[model samples]
Target: MSLMLGYLEDYAKNRRGSHNYHTILVMGYAVAGKPEFALQLFGRMRYQGIDLDVFAYHVLLNALVEGNYYDGVEAVSNQIKSRGFESEVTHSILIKSFCRKKEFDRAETYLRRVMEGEVKIKGGGYIVGALVDGLCKDEQFDRAGKLVDEFGEFHVYDIWIRELVRARKLDGAMEFLHKTRNVVQYVPDLFRYNTLIIRLLRENRLEEVCDLIIEMRESNIPPDELTMNTVLCFFCKGGMVDIALRLYDSRGQIGLSLSSMAFNYLMNTLCGDGSVVDAYRILKNALEQGYFPGVPTFSVLAHALCKLEKLDMMNELFHVALENNVVLSDRIHEIYIQALCRTGRVEDGYYIHGELNRLNKVTTGCAYNSLINGFIKSNRADIAVRLLIEMQEKGHTPSRQLFRTVIQSVCETENPEKQFQRLLEMQLSLHEIDCGVFNIFIEGAGLAKKPDLANEVYQMMKRSGISPNVTSDILLLRSYLRGEKVSDGLHFFHNILERRAIGRKVFNTLIIGLCKANKPDIALSYFTNIRAKEKTVRPSLECYEELIYVLCNHKRYDKILDVIDDLIDVGRPLSSFIGNNLLLHSLKDRELYDTWVDSRPPTELTQPESSHIWRLREVVGLFSDRFRDDISIDDLEQVVRNCFPLDIYTYNMLLRKLCAKQVDDADKLFDTLCPKGYEPNQWTYETMVHGFYKHGRKDHAKLLLKEMVQRGFRPSEVTSALL
Candidate 1:
């Protein structure tokens, strides 16, 4: 690598003013995993004032990522921003590196930066896939899905389906696939179908696999070879060999080509279950069709023949493989050995194992574990243990499940402490202990009603340097709550608050718990604290409504009003039910009603129309005494003019008050409003007609009704009835 770099440097020095030299040099060094040297070359190029393009920046960023230098990746990313270069490749590199390092928060932050247009990174499937994979590994499945939705890119569905399958969320994967059928411009392709089908087959969900295939065909997506094989393998494993045969026979009709793996799997499954004649018939048909079976098919069939004690048929299959130029693989040898052991041919199994060992093909733990499991199942536990020891001596770590099995066997010996110690020892030896293991213990203890044990497990987790996640905190919280240790739960809640470890969900849970315990006061205090201190915590409407209802039940009207005020201040209105409850409670007391009215800021009211009507009613109530008394026209007019804005509605309202007091001045006020551009609506014309008729001026009333009709304003029904 150094020699290569030296040559590139010499070439760059000789080929001065050529940016391609430096760019090629950087790419070569990056691919070689010597990214630091690439970065040094980049700096030298920059020193020489060579113009760097987006590709050059992309190369440097990729080099930093290849070296796992995250900080350097960040620095180069910022430099890209500072230099006004927009390279999607650089952004994708940064995202991929952060996700690979499991720094998902940084990955998400960069994604959001790109989304918000702070960074000029174009969103595509590659960057989205990396972040989504990171999120799924972190068990943020829903968030990853939502991120895909926010980007609205259908190509990211492959990543989403794969992650769901990895998380064992096959149902969710299927649902997402079905949902994609409705998305504009996104057709569920064969790759997506195969991903879900493979997972379903692993889960033994053959019925669902069949249904999905039917659905795929209905949607016009013909099943491919992989799909057919997956379905056939599933049917074979489920002991429905007849269905597997029928599907294989109709492969051409289903638009699928028969593959060797599928053929081998079917033959092997049939022979292992004592259907040798059927397996031979399928093999004969395939060979007649001129299809050459590969090494796997040959190995499986040969092993199956050996299982049936048909050494002659097995040798014939081997000759066929030789004729077809098929070379046997290590996997084939392993399968043959396992088949021999399963048939109680231990001597032959050992012979194959020795031959493979001489050829260096028996080095994998899988081979050892296969024989070990076979011995254990055959009532030869002592031999299994011996093989396990030999496997370790060969520098192969036995399968994790092997240790688990041994520990289970020891646990059945009825020594709890010893069993736990052995389990821990195994974990230490294998370095496989993680928070998830402890979480299982904690969850089990909680379910078992042993909060003390759960707490101990939690402490062990902390001592092991495994910081608790939200799930861990929730498990411990649930333990405390279930044990009725309210104080401990409260303390844990405080710790979460202090560290800001809890999200809105935990805060809500805490609040709801307190409220359910009849501690509305405490719940309110926490809700207020969350609203004030944590900008991200948005308490649900249901939460606020529940607390308000509790406060109202307790007749804590002032506090209820405060909660409503805060909710409004944040532009979140209380629901109508809660708002009506507040109104009902306030109306019972004059002082409380006044306080509620004054608490709401003018801008926070519902809508302009409703607010206008409400204010008009309030104004009328304020002048109720004056209206009842025999106030003079001038005094009433002065009061209406001074207190209201004199819009059409207000003018109509004031005119109605005036008409009952002084009909002449009411007519004068109507005339004055018209000259001031306040045209009379239906209400205005109705009020005037009624006033004229009451004052024994029927002629004037008739004239006004005609004018009302001419102006396209109809009088009220009451006015027409009176006429």
Candidate 2:
């Protein structure tokens, strides 16, 4: 407008425009809301003897009033009247001008004067409608209502209803809306219902909003996009998600384009309802409509989709976030990455993890864990080890199990030494070469059966001027035993003893490791040394159980009895593994029971109730016929349970003994196995299979073997031969 005005002024200075062109210019500025310029041009028009017509005058007058320029309005009104071109628009403009200037009395006088014919102005509806609207705008709502009542015109009532709703008088808006619908037998317009409904929705008057929407339907007033969008929001927030979802689906048919708030509400509510897939669909549609959800809403829906393992949707969501430049929270990104890893999309997860890197984001500890484990499962532990070290460098603490997994996975590689050495170099370089870090390398080498490598790491630890802690000594000793370098292990153990007094933990690790290495003689020698102490430091119960198991494996029944005497002397209750071992060995051969009877102290057998020897004596009688009348297998299981909670191995022993006499007892024990929450292992299955075959139920035995194989437990050699 300014450009045009400037051009026109230059044009006029050169040559004048026609009267119609000049008038058009004045109206143009007024219509364009450049009232100052419009009035300036109007004054120019009058000076040039070019007067605006009635329509131009009224347009200028209304524009002045709208711009709150009462001075221009008065000047324009007087000019229209002086030209005798006054109409109802002229007085209405004056009345509106007075109201805008807060001169209510003058506005009301003009209305009365015009109505009474004192002023012969026409356009009664136009005149009264403007004043009532102005009154409502001025918050003279009661007076506006009275004016609406006095006129009793639908147009006036409609204007007042809009005013009421705009002022947030929702109840009054609805009341007048009902009046229009009831007494007047007319639906005001879509705007009326929509505005009222929106206000009601804002105030959470859901029932009323629903009623008004119904009213629109019953009145045959077709809903616009706003109405449908509002309804979708209402249904979603009110826990009527099914209806909301239906409305969302029919968005195209109903001409419903979702508003930002409606989209936010629908997606968030759907996720809360566990309708994650549907929420994902809505999110896709929302993106199409160019509505980028806020962070919280996107996160809620993204997490839900991830939880439900809707990977395809989560992938799309990730791309959407990427494409839109939506910076999701690290936690949300971590959720997607972890979910991908869980669903075996580790490569895809790693790809996204790179995205986090490019974004300069620190991957969460939990995500690193999942990704590392995922890579391990994929046999990419080389990659997993790198991530583990990276995780530590980023100041996140990897779980011991996680580190163990990476190390174990590395040990399982084809060239474990090369890979593990590579990993160890990286690990040691990540921090100072403390004993703890070197211990991990030793432990890893031990696990790889590379006792030589483990010894090298131990030496390196000493070279770093960090003397080995007991933990370090234990790891190196176990490494030797794990590699079956029993001589080396013995040397290391004696060196440890020479340097300092070791605790039960070190003794237990060596004893257990040696037992695992099948060197029971060395383990027993150490056990002897432990028992020979004046204040003999009792080995752990687990250590005792391990020694007795290896002793049973060696069939050194006399040695087993000697260990049992040491166990009794140490005041440690016999573990179920030890007791069950004795029973199983007795059932296999008379060696254990004979050893017990031969080594029995003549007076210890008569020991008081405080003595565990009595229990040991009864356990021996389980094999001999001497206790058959006094003790049943059921009685023995109970006695064992009372002594120490019976393990599954104990149950296997009981099942074996029962198979010799009553197959019914074995069947009973097998049935109770599941109810006792005992997951049957290979030994348990073998015991049952043996029981079945001996009882002449070959089909049952084969069936048990099949189940064992199905459970990933291979049948033992003896059981296979029987089958």
Candidate 3:
């Protein structure tokens, strides 16, 4: 409008203006609804001794009325009347002026007066349509309906229903449509139905929307693009996928052009319904139609495709999103990257990850796990270790397992020292000078079995002017023991002992690591030495459990009984690992039971907390089904619960108890324990398989093996031999 006005003004300046130009200016401003400017132009035209023709005169008058300039309306209408510019147009404008002022009664009276005139206006329904619209705006729907009923004009009916729908009086509009449902010459057009259906769809009033859609088909009223899109969205929302697909498939025949909103809803609903193939097709078609679904819909589909391993399609969709400038969410990117790595496309995932880093997107810890592990599998351990360091710099803490995985990969690579040193340097440079950074390096090296590198990192920590904390000392000592360099561990132990830093946590580490490395003699030496000198200090439960485990593996039950005595004296309850280990071994070695019975001092039974040793004896006897009471399978788990917390390993022990003798009881126990929040492991399955096979129930054993394989577990050697 501004550009047109500028062009008009320029034309007037270049050519000495004429009356025609002046006339157009007046009418243009009037039709443009700028009554003030048009009226001002009117005054100028009069001053230049030019007057408006009837068309311009009526145009200016209507503009005043439409602008609600009542004072100007009265003045202009009086001038228009004096000039004898009166016609049906003048009367129509006058009636509209009355209605615009909310004078519906006066408007009706003027309408009657005009109808009585012999001028006989053609298409007079517009005059009544204006009155009905005003009445409806004033919330006088009763009066508006009455006027429409009396006039019975096609245009008035259209205005009445459209206004009623706009006013959210949908029931009243539908009721009025029902009243006029006589299949007459007049009926509401598809716009009114589209308005009603669109609103109902939004409100999830699917029943009413369905009814109206059927009504449209019955009335033979041709549906428009809006109606088509609304029906498509309606089907998707209503879970009417077949109908939606039928309609969508016939789009070319029906000339369907989808809007963006409908496109998004359809895509999201299709993905929700697990129709990813159909959704993929719709996505391609929508893109062809220049309709880009919303970011949420794109992510929903991306997740679906990734979950189903439709990687080729997912690859295409991801690039399509990027090319269209869709900002994929972090979760979407993470899953996509993981899927790519799972499909052996680590380099592609790496490129995407690099792009995310360049764009400063939040690369989550899970995504890094996938990429780091993926690169490890691809023989790119250097990159894997570097990414591990970079992840920590980006505020992600790799778990101990993750650190071990990367370090193990580094150990396998050529020139591992160079790779490890570079990664350590990157970690040290990016982090503050602290023992924690050094400890991570030391721990990683220890896990990789590089004790020399671990010691180098420890010395580097001291050289950097940072005091090594207790964790640093422990990790360093364990590195040597873990690398089987017991000589180095003993050397560090003497150094710490000379410096007077040997304490409870350090002694516990030595005992546990020595036991783990099969040097039970050294571990037992430290355990006894710590107990002798530091009477107040005792080994941790884990330290006792490790000693018991390695000793049991060595079949030294007398030493095991001595350890249990120390364990009871420590005032700690037996952990499931310790208890399960002792029980499973006693089942194999009859001497263990005899050792426990022989080693329990008669007076020690009277001591405080000595009942735990008695409980272990009872459990061993109970497993042999030699207890006094014949316990039911129901009592079996509860009895164990009274003794120790049941883990997967504990359940495996319990299953082993009945596997040989009471195989049915073992099967029942297996089925019942799962609902109590216990997940079965490979050994759990093996226990049941062995139990079934022991009872000559080969069919049950075969079934159990099949189930085990289905649950992602393969039978162990013993389990396979039983089958």
Candidate 4:
């Protein structure tokens, strides 16, 4: 590999050959997973006055990105820019850099600059793809859509842009895509089409995605594994178990091989959504094809069996994993045990536990925790306690999680205070109890409304040199609040705020308790005092909304304006639910808009309204499967009148759609264009001819051919093929 690399490096610098040696050198390093070496070679080659072509740049840029050497990327970019050669590859590299660093603005700036500059290396599908991906990542749909249009000269952008649209960046992706109405490289081979379709499926845009198999038939593109897997995933995502079974229906015709990874993804998705029977059917299909199932597939199957309380199915999946030489993970074994235990099979869970113990694989705390949780769930607290003791005897110290689970379980069965006291005593006999364990006890005591017990737990925590967390303090405060011990709750809240510095959530909980106890005035006093002191600290949107809600219920409408002002200043619009209620409440006060919209801070006006919902709809519309449906002649005319009046691409798209429906209408459409003061170019004739051939209308094709011959317009390969 190094020798091949050395030859490429020498060739790139020699500059004597027609072959692109730098490209070869860079490719060698990229393929070898040593992209840094490729960059190093590129740096040295630059000093030799040999221009790094687009191909060389891509390989090196990809290598740099793949190896995560981001800082080096800018240097190469500057070098390209300095030479006044911002090729598509250079732009793509810059876009990729921003994508990796998540600095989308810089990537976009470079893209626009690439568009503005002369063609150093003519832009292609990949350049547009990188920009679309970056914009999608940054959630900047509007600009991405426009950029797609600018780069939509090639049909490749259609496939990737569709992918972006499917990824839910449809509005930005479509603005560019909708400009070109021709069937983009519609059959962009199988891989690109599959990628776009599968992405659409993931985004739940099934109705919009067309029958890809049928699309391939129309376009004469052969179907591959990628195409089949895409459709299979769609069926799996849609819960169309019968459609998934159609793999068997087409296996003989399409020569399908149900790839293990694809099968695993389908099984996992189905099982996760509790479609175990569907998963089982898929596995059975795989079995019929003589393919061994993988570990993840079996693991999901086991999980589903556990959910359904099917111990026999769980065991069968477990054995299948082993039969297929699939290594069972601790999760799988734990699920198997839990499933067995739930169905009155504790002996089976224990037996598996014993087998793990014998193999000395029960060292981790996770497997033990799973078993203990299972026991607690089954009301077998005594068995859970025994298991903890067994774990300790094996020199594996019990985790705080384990202790908390067992203690909480014991509390349910008997006097929790007595059990906690016993555990505290037991802790003294061994090592110290964890702060987390004490916190858990405090929470349990608070939940049981035992303030004294919770206080005792807190005191124990301090004495053990295990300081209570904010959670522990909150629990203790809640205990006091529940008992209407306002002074105690307030004192604890202050200490917690001072010591642990608990945030809004804890503060909100305390304030809520005060309001519930009919101490709204006191709660308001505390709220005012907190707001005055903590300049940096502010209520969350939920806290502010809830406070407003409480005030509204008390007919304290005067106080709501202040909270609304705060919300407006913080740039939080009311949620749809709250907005409806707020509108009703605002009707009672003329000063509502003054507080909500014309707030104290002029800076708040600068904040953009949340574009999430609007952008989401726009994106959905862009990748919408609606476009694939057959458009009526009337609809085409309407689209032309409304959408095409200003936009050339829309006119072209409408023209293509209309011409597709009636091929001989090309002359009539051209005449209509002249009367409308618009000139028709080769694009118009090309689209009509392409459409004629696409639908196999040979008479219309011959007519166009005869016209072209008379007009002295020679046919290109595409035009010849159309004829």
lDDT of each: 0.70, 0.82, 0.82, 0.64
- TM per candidate: 0.39, 0.65, 0.73, 0.37
- lDDT for model 1, please: 0.70
- Residues 1-723 of candidate 1 have per-residue lDDT tens digits of 678768776876788656487778777777667888777777787788864577778877877876788777877788888987855666677788887788888888987777667544455666777788778888988888888887756667778877788788987877777777666536667887788888888888888888888988888888888889778877888888888988977877897676766777798778778777678778878888887666666666666676676654554564566567665666655666666666777656666677556556554567777777776566564566567666776788765567545433333343434544445444455446777666655564555445665687788889988888777777776666555666787898888768665687787667765665567788788888777888777777777777887887776766776776566566665465564444344334444445445665665456453443344324333344312455665665554444333467666666776676578888888888867887789888898899899999999999999999999986667888999
lDDT of 2 by residue, 1-723 (tens): 567667656755665555488777777778777788889989987897888888988989989998988788888888888999888878778888888888888888888888888665446877888899888888888988888878766677778878888999988888777876788786778988788888887787878886887787788887898788887887887898998888788777666788888888888888989999888877777777777788888788888888888888888887888788887888988999899998899999999889988988899999999999999999997789889988898899887677767887888888887887788888878777788788777787788787888888788788878999988899889889999998889899889989998788788998899899898898898888776873546678899899999999898877887887778777888887788777777778876777777876688667875556677667667755456543455676876665566888888877777777777777788888999898778888888888888889999999989989999997878888888
Off by over 4 Å in 4: 1-309, 313-331, 341-351, 358-370, 385-410, 424-436, 465-472, 482-487, 494-506, 512-519, 533-536, 569-723
Rank order by lDDT, top first? 3, 2, 1, 4
Ranking, TM-score, top scorer first: 3, 2, 1, 4
Each model's total of backbone clashes: 0, 0, 0, 6
**Candidate 4, residue 254: how far the Cα is off, in Å:** 29
By the lDDT metric, which is better: model 3 or model 4? 3
Candidate 2 has its poorest 10 consecutive residues by lDDT at 624-633
Prediction 3 global C-alpha lDDT: 0.82
Summarize candidate 3's per-residue lDDT along 189-279 as a digit string, tens digits.
8777888888777767777876876677687876778888988888898898877877788878767887777777778888888888999
Candidate 1 Cα errors over 4 Å, as ranges: 1-19, 94-110, 118-130, 183-185, 273-277, 292-723
